[model samples]
Target: MPASSSRLSSYRLPAFALALLLLLGVGIASVWGVSSLRTSNEWIGHTYEVINRIEVAERAIRSTEANARAYRLTGHPEFRSQYLIATHQVDTAHEALASAIRDNPAQHARVKRMREAAQAHLVELRRLFDLQELQGAEAARQATNSTLTLRQWNEFDTAASEMRREELRLLDQRKARSDRSATLLSAIVVLGMLLSGGLMISLMVSVTRENKRARRLELEARGAAHEMALSMAQVGELSKQRHELARYSGLLQSCQTLDEIVQLSIDTIRRLVPDASGRFYLIRASQNFHDSVASFGDHLISSPDSLMPADCWALRRGQAHMVSGEEARQLSCAHLDTGTPAPGITSLCLPLSAQGTSIGLLHVSAATDAMDHGSAVDELIGQLAEQLGLAIANLQLRETLRTQSLRDPLTGLFNRRYLEESLARELQRCERRNLPLSVLMLDVDHFKRFNDTHGHAAGDALLGQVGRQIQAGVRAEDIACRYGGEEFTVVLPELDAAGALVRAEQIRRAVEIATVQHLGQQLGPVTMSIGISTFPGDGLTPEVLLQLADATLYRAKAEGRNRVLHVSYDD
Candidate 1:
């Protein structure tokens, strides 16, 4: 009995020790795997930042060059300030780029070459400035024709391009490595749980065969616990990512202007899809053109400025076109400027459509030719495009409705409703500023008889011509309205009685000399009667001012039709 007890005691110590050691090993392995994955994710984010900085440097340099040319030509002080600011930004951005790539020897060398070339280009720009100061603008212009400037720019461009390509290559490599690390982490956790369960069960079996049933149940329970913990962790992470996407999508939906929509979409989508470059094209239906309104990232597909409906295969087919892979090899879209696809870049043009109608195309460019898109990224881009299309379409409908309500159908002038609104607002404004506002009430002379002599169509044409003349003569801030049937009104702010009378005379004389032609017949010269009324001096309120002007207009017709009349308060 003593020997058997001793044997059991010896087995139990070694078994417990081994089980405890195995537990520690599993825990340590799991922790190491998770840490590796976190490190990889950080590196991937850094790579994206580096690539973005490189593109920023490219943009800054281009701006500097453009502003430098403008400053040399016009000698405008504002242009000089702009050139200085843009040049300063380029310097700051290059320094940032250099700092970002310090660890990489190859990248550091390329950035050095770019920096040297940029410095030389800036020196040449200053040379032009110095030349302009000593000599004239013509000499500066002659210096602008120097080959040395172009050569320096070309060298800088070449260096910048090489660095961009290298960064893109690094981005891909780092992304793959990050993905592998995440996969490895998950595998390690699962394997550790399995190993611990197996070891615990074997120890239970070796320690006692009589309690095998109970120990087997215990082993299964432990295994179930580990899996449950893992699943809960995964669920929590997925929920967090989903929450982020939902919040950003809500922001996209709330955007007001086309610019706001484009800027927000680019900012959010780039974070979700690293190393992506693309342009957003908005369809201008009035111009019958597809225009590039917004862009982000780098390596964009060069689509034309004025694109036709038939030019985009995506628009023609009513579907998205992937300009990479075998399916894309079938036909290139008309929007693309190339017959053959560029190497190491993936291009996709998805029509931004709402309901059953198409609006515009979203062209996405990937750094790699393979265009390997993760499911999450593809889903995000699709969601952004869908929301943007709906928002912009709604804005278009709203603008159309607003315009129709405010403009007259025949004369293309503001209607009475707009005139009333403008008058009320401008009166309040001018009253506060202590400025004068003038109202001109004018009518075509003998319109009833003229309409009967010509046809109603001719009268309408005559009214349109007068409306256009009034539009051309008034300041942009002034309001010209069709005051119903052959009558017109102009609301001119900051114009007193004297200025108003002068303007009314100009309109009266212009109408007296103008002749209208209908079909094969030429009518006699037309004439207008205009009455001017000034605010505070003639009348204060819009109602009083308009009434006074109308009364004066009647007096003008009574005295002589083709002359201007001023109805003063002192009268």
Candidate 2:
């Protein structure tokens, strides 16, 4: 052998030795990888089984709780069926978990102890349920304390905790083996470094760029979450405002009479969202929206006759009709031309409906929409209008019922019931106000003789004529009711003895002057006898006042009728 052949053979022997060492390392690493994989797979299977068992246990607990609530609420036989099903499911869950963990030596050793504790707790719960059914709610509540619930919860929690531990251990082992394999591969790669070193640097740059992008995305996600929270808070505030508006609407609905409804509606609008001035307009039988009723800045417009039909675009549209700038020139009204409401005024008009008919329009004037007034404001206004319309309609119904109950249909004057009610109310008012109230009782003289001579139809017409004359002679605040037969009574509020005498004389004179014409037959002048009595000075009670007035009326009759007489009552 030459020197060169000898040197090459030496190099080959060392290379073969290094290759054999690498092969042995590869074999060891392969065995470790297989062992780690088997351990991970086993942990996965065990974890799945544990999860399945826990799910079953949770299902059983939920079903049991539902059945318990149902049985407590209804106490039905069907609820017993559900309760039994739930208890069976719980037993199955407990048994399945126990059987699955039987092969695990450590688990098996501790399970008996766990099972004993669990069984003890379950028995206590069962006894508690029985006691609750037999005894009372308080005893049951005391039995279902935190201890038993926590113990049952702990059973699953402990098993899940052990499974998590085992799973994590296996994962760690797998990771370690995988890391070793990676390290060996890295070493081999380094041994061949010069060929792929530039590619590794490029890969590292791409990874760094990706990490920066992920951090930016996280910041953006946080910003979006904060914005969403702010929007949700604003929405919550809007919901609160809407609820407050609904309350105001309900308050508007409870008005007892038309006048009361008007006062309440005005007050509600003033108290809530008061920036806008509102007014209600009633359409006449002519189908024209006219400003018959209105309240402005704490003052009510009392001119029932002053209102007339004007072509208002707002009312015609049945929506918000706003006119600003030069366009307002076409609209003619003292409210618009004088600028009392100021310029740039926006008007929202809602149509009032009662019994499916458009009755009128309600107009609201606002300076700005930023007052939280927009379409939502318009809808609220509509609801308010609807409530008002219903209240007015109810008031009308009550008035009709009241008239039917207390008024004489033929004369449109108060009947006997009205006389009684008026007397009671006047007595109460006199007591409260500490004022002297008087009643004047009047009776038509020779009415029956007149009816006998002229006929019953003439007598009824004469009575209607007397009713109108009396209504016109008295103040609007006074109440007039027809007593039985030809007698009538008038409640003279705030009137004392002298005032009552003056009113009684005025009524007598008016009846003497009133002429009744029936079927073109001119009846002679009619006359009435009047009697007056003062309250408190006479008697505090309603019956006493009326009786004293009635006595005085009989005195007027005894004094040859058609005269006024003052009645006296014993104090």
RMSD of 1: 32.4
Clashing pairs in 2: none
After superposition, the stretches of candidate 1 with alpha carbons farther than 4 Å from their true spots are 1-277, 286-288, 296-311, 323-345, 354-357, 366-373, 428-436, 452-458, 493-503, 517-524, 535-541, 567-571
In the range 412-486, model 1's lDDT, one tens digit per residue, is 999999999999899999999999999999999999998998889889888887888788778889999999998
How many backbone clashes does every candidate have? Answer: 1, 0
lDDT of each: 0.79, 0.68
Give every collision pair in model 1: 344-369
> TM-score for all predictions?
0.50, 0.52
Please give me the total number of clashing residue pairs in predicted model 1. 1
Q: Model 1, 366: alpha-carbon shift in Å?
A: 5.1
Worst 10 residues of 2 by lDDT: 298-307
Error of 2 at 130 (Å): 87
